[model samples]
Target chain A: MGKHVITMLPGEGTGPEICEAVRRIIDHTGVEIVWEYEEIGLDCLDKYGTLLPEKTIKSIAKNKLAIKGPTTTPIGTGHKSANVTLRKMFDLYANVRPAKLIPVLKRPWDKIDILTFRENTEDSYAAIEHMVSDEVAQCLKVITWPGSYRIADFAFKWAKANGRKKIQCVHKANIMKMTDGLFLEAFREAAKKYPEIEYGDIIVDNCSMQLVRNPGQFDCLVLPNLYGDILSDLCAGLVGGLGFAPGANIGDNCAIFEAVHGSAPKYAGMKKVNPSAVLLSGVMMLRWIGENAAADKIENGMNKVLAEGKTLTYDAGGTASTDEYADAIIKAMN
Target chain B: MLTKATTGRAKRPAKPITLVGVDVYIITENGIPAFDDYGAFKIEFVSNRGTKVWPGYVSEDLMLVNWYRCRFMATKAVTDADVDSFLTQLSKKWKWSAAQKLWNYGDEAGFSKAY
Candidate 1:
């Protein structure tokens, strides 16, 4: 059995708690993974004077695989998101967020499965704001041909491989004619190559309305950076919430799987927050590494635990602690 | 040796800092058009990535940067809302990436390198 070395980033707040829970559950899979732990986010900021340490980045760069917990991005100012920094550092242009309905959870919509492919590198996220004067400011929204094409290509390839039938390109090209227009054009170009898959375009506003109205109609969605950031959260609402959302940032050389939810600072060290998001992210990591059997087993274990409604954390409407929840899933796996 | 008289111009309150024009960078496939009247405003000149490429330009082999900056000058001083309206109208036909407002500082231009 070959041991797979993966960089583990226990971020901030409840990040460590959930990551520990996920680590224990994954260990039971007998997958022989060597977890290289790295400290990041606020803790790293305190120790190293930077949120994202150079050493941590080098570890992930060397290992090529990382599973991370939620990190805090201070409101108003302090520092930019460490996640965004990492994404830009590795050129992780494709942000894949999968939102699937848990059968046990009672939600407004049912059978909602959506895979959001967000172009993560550019757009307003480039952080190029300039104060033109005392009364005005501007931020450059960069949308390159290469950036657009690669993300669209990744979406189509992933959709085809995952047995998805349709790919929807969501944008506000009607208003942001150039930046978003380039994105739509690239999507159309990529669609032509994947002739087997049905392709369509929708304005970002209408896409939001349609998502909430009939999420099932969308099989797979590919969008620019800003729209993807917004719609992925909206799609997460369709299934359950961010607590169950699993995200993966993938580039050519490295991939990092993470929980879409933020670090619940108030619940830090309480052992009460739900670990479903990070746990499912670990499942995604398993699949990414070709451990289909282990992935399926862990996924099935999660489904069983949720369906039983016996052992669950506070967010899931149960009294069990994070470790207890992981214990239940590990026990159920056997 | 042209020395202009600064009699009444020196007493004026620096023209109150008015918006004279705006440079709208539109992403076009075929580069900037040679003659775009814009109806209300004048299309002074067009440039590809800061190098003037249209309206009696220098080099014959001009490289298109996808982003073409078209300087549109108004007949009179315009407000911020007027600039917004102008951009809104232009967006219907051309895909614009960015717009920078050009100001007239008394006699000289506020933004450097007019063309």
Candidate 2:
């Protein structure tokens, strides 16, 4: 097989550190890949006067496959989110985050496995906010049938493709009936096409409650943008925090696998932060590119290292440095 | 314990507000506001395309527009809770695009002349 050319976005702060660790681990997998490095987020903003540089966009556009680290999105209005900008640019409409309990990690829940499919575009993320008056500020919640249908279809097809048994459509249709009602309607229409998969609908609030109570019952969840954003983080907290979460933004042509955690600028140069999220994201990237064997190998190795409760970073309750932790996983692979 | 009597600012009695009416626009399938009567409140009038299209509306092809504005008046003085109940009931039958509360300031009309 020919070498796969993939775009590597080493983002700002601790992004570079984790990306380096993930790159080393991916290299150890012996997969033939040509890495095209690109800059994004805060560092890119400093250099190119744009958070998402044109060169980075072109690189991902040309390659169609990317593995990225966490990029900072300045709070309280400095610049728009680089992540959102990239998603819109690529039309990466499906945001997939899988939360599965690791055997070694001690948590309140066990045997928990859930996949969250979030609509990547449209909804409140459209950033449409204006003041009707000083007292009344309105933000339009836009949900089109086409947008809802495509995301619902993507969730169903993804479930069917991955051999998932059920899909639950989460929405607030009872309240914002027009916007969320249209979403639920689209989900129902899409569910009819896939008769094999068990389809159900739950209000967003109820879905959140149930997810915490008995998450084992849920197989796959499809939600509109806002609910997905909030629920995905909640789900992340179920198994483990964002440190162990890996995310993928997938469209028809382009896919960007990334760590769901923030850049953690405080731990940027210390090499103390955990790289599990980014490394697992790399594992996801490997699977996307048809290197399933390498993906499985790395996943198993990481699991073994975690299971042993040795050679872990400070966050994981061990004294090992980030590089030391990466080495341990690589050693397990051997 | 020191009470509010020691404070310099005097507390005024809370003003009572009541629901007079509501101007609701229900968005339909074709993105046009639907001209439908909400049973709980009296349907004062319905307008489309900046012209009255219901209850003494002129029959014209131009009046067949998607956007609709309906004025619903309460039978008596209703509290904010009553308005909430009205909205909950209205949402069941129609996809409300926009809603504005019609408050009566004694002799003042909260509604616009366009209605």
Candidate 3:
């Protein structure tokens, strides 16, 4: 097969370690992938004066496919999130996060498979905020026709393709009528076109309760930026947690696969944290590049390691270093 | 003044003039200023992002930012000297970032509706 080039963003902290584990695992698949490394986040601030540099963005723009480790953004400053910046820069409006049970792992709920399509660009996450007065502040919640409809369209199309039976649009339309109402309107319009899929609307608060109470009732959920950012994590809890959560921010031309979890800078250089999230993200990148066989091998191998319960990280209830766990998965590959 | 059009004809028009207004955006976090020093101009209204919030009715739900746009309408015919004096007075109390003059070009309003 021809060699594929992917932009690899090794973010700060344990980002590099997990990225290495993923690189080794991908290499074992024998699929030639050139990881064009790029630097970003807090570490690059002194050198580039910005968390996201032009060169790094150029690499992602050219390669069109990137897998990233979590990058940290300084808190309570004017600096925009590097993660949010990349998504908006690429117009990666559809943030697809799939939460499914890892057959071997023990959790409160079983057989939980939910796909969350979050509208990545608009909404209150746009960071348009100002202190009206010393006591009053405002952050504009923006929802547009094209932005809402496109994400809804993406979710519906993906649901139809993946044989998802039910799709729910979650929002607080009762309160923020115009903004959230437009989101629900877009979902309804998209749902109309896909008559085969059973689509409905739910208030975000109620949706959260239902998700925890009976997650199996839903198959797919499409939501605005803030709600999706929150509920996707809740759904992840239903299966395992951020450790098992694999996220993809996809636009028309470019896509970035990344773990939903933070960099966990405290765990840096320890080889202690679970590599499941990033490695599974790599599997997503593999499948996106049409390397289905390699993707299948990685997923199956990971499942086997989980089922065997011999080589697993501390989070997964076993004693294995990040590399050791990855090695086991690679060895288990058929 | 006459200018030649593409058809090689001199474009002519009737002299057009009307009363105009100006909006001075001041950063209010520093301080609010006295509105009495404007020469031949009166403060019509002040708004935050097009919502009326001063001199009359202010919404309780309206969140205030540090920036306020003060609309000044000319009481009489305005001159550059009048504008200079107003700005000079405003500069002493508040930091004004931008001032946009609302023009009446013939019969059309040259600025956006602040609704």
Candidate 4:
């Protein structure tokens, strides 16, 4: 097969180094790939004058596939998040994150596999806020039928394809009946199509408690933006941390694979942060592009490396640098 | 706990304020690009969730929903009868979700630009 040309956005802080490590690891897998580098986030603001350069947007629009390292969104008032902008621009409605138990992280649960499908574009993330009065502030919680149905359908379809059984819609419909109610209603409507898949709904708070109590009970949980944002991390905590979780933003036309964690600025030039998240994200991207054999190889290799615990990054309680850890996985692959 | 003796209020300036335009929000899957003038009111442009998306080379990459806000400005001083007539004609073809009147306090606009 000819080389797959994919747009690579090496984001701010520790993004570039970890992306480089992931690239090296993927290269070792013998999957032919041509990387097209793109810029996004604050680091590129000086040169591009915009967080998301137009060229980068054009590249993603053309390629239809991208792998991004963690990008930093500054706290408080600033530009709108480039990540949010990309998702909205491309209509990447489904944020799929798989947080499964990695055997190495000896948590209490022997088997905890949870797939989170987050509605990427709607809810409070819409950035629709205005001061209704001098004291009272209002943020419009926009939820539409089309947006809800598409994400719910995506979740159900994804679960069915991936051999998952149960799918749950998590929401806070008891309180905000109209907004969250619309979400749950859409999930129910979508659920009717896939009768083979057992579907149900749970309130967000109870779902959180259920997750921490016994995560093994759930297979896949589809949630609105706010709940999913909170629960996806909780799901990550079950496995190990953000380092073990890999995420992807998928739409009808485009898909962007990325690490769910943020870029740790303190570890930028240190070569000390873990590359597992981005590497695993690369594995997901490989599977997405039909390079399943290479994906399996890298995944198995990483699993072996994690199992051995001989060479691991500091986050995993070892002294190995990022390059050394990646090299270990690369060596294990062969 | 400390509390203010009285709540502050904003008072209108002594300068004259007049109605200049109206933003009519319509719910539609595909946005309406142009509409004819109703009496003295002329359709300026249409925006979706505050981003301008019509009357020129607008990128198809914008994520569109059902909400579209259309701005219509008056060539002369618009009265309540003018708004009623325009909406009456507008209702014949399209259904409007909401409408907000634009005002000019002296030289400054009461509302922000669509862009």
Best by lDDT: 4
Model 2 chain A worst lDDT window (10 residues): A128-137
- Candidates arranged by DockQ, highest first: 4, 1, 2, 3
What is candidate 3's lDDT per residue for A197-302, written digit by digit as tens? 9989999999999999998888999999999999999988889889889999998888999999999999999988898898888888888788989999999999
- Candidate order by lDDT, highest to lowest? 4, 1, 3, 2
Clashing residue pairs found in predicted model 4: none
- Tens digit of lDDT per residue, candidate 4, span A231-303? 9999999899998789999988889999989999988999999999988889889988889999999999998
TM-score of each predicted structure versus truth: 0.76, 0.75, 0.75, 0.85
**Candidate No. with top TM-score:** 4
Prediction RMSDs, each to the true structure: 12.7, 12.0, 17.4, 4.6
Candidate 3 global Cα RMSD? 17.4
Model 4, stretches more than 4 Å misplaced?
A: B1-24, B29-32, B35-64, B69-94, B99-115
Q: Which candidate would rank higher by DockQ, 1 or 4?
A: 4
What docking class should model 3 receive?
incorrect
- Candidate 4 local Cα displacement, residue A100, angstroms: 1.0
| Winning model by DockQ | 4
lDDT tens string, model 1, A73-122? 87753576789877766667799999889876798776788899999877
Instruction: After superposing candidate 1 on the true structure, give the runs of residues whose Cα lies further than 4 Å from its correct spot.
Output: B1-115
Write model 1 residue lDDT over B3-53, tens digit each, in one string: 575444443343446678887878878755554455556888775434456
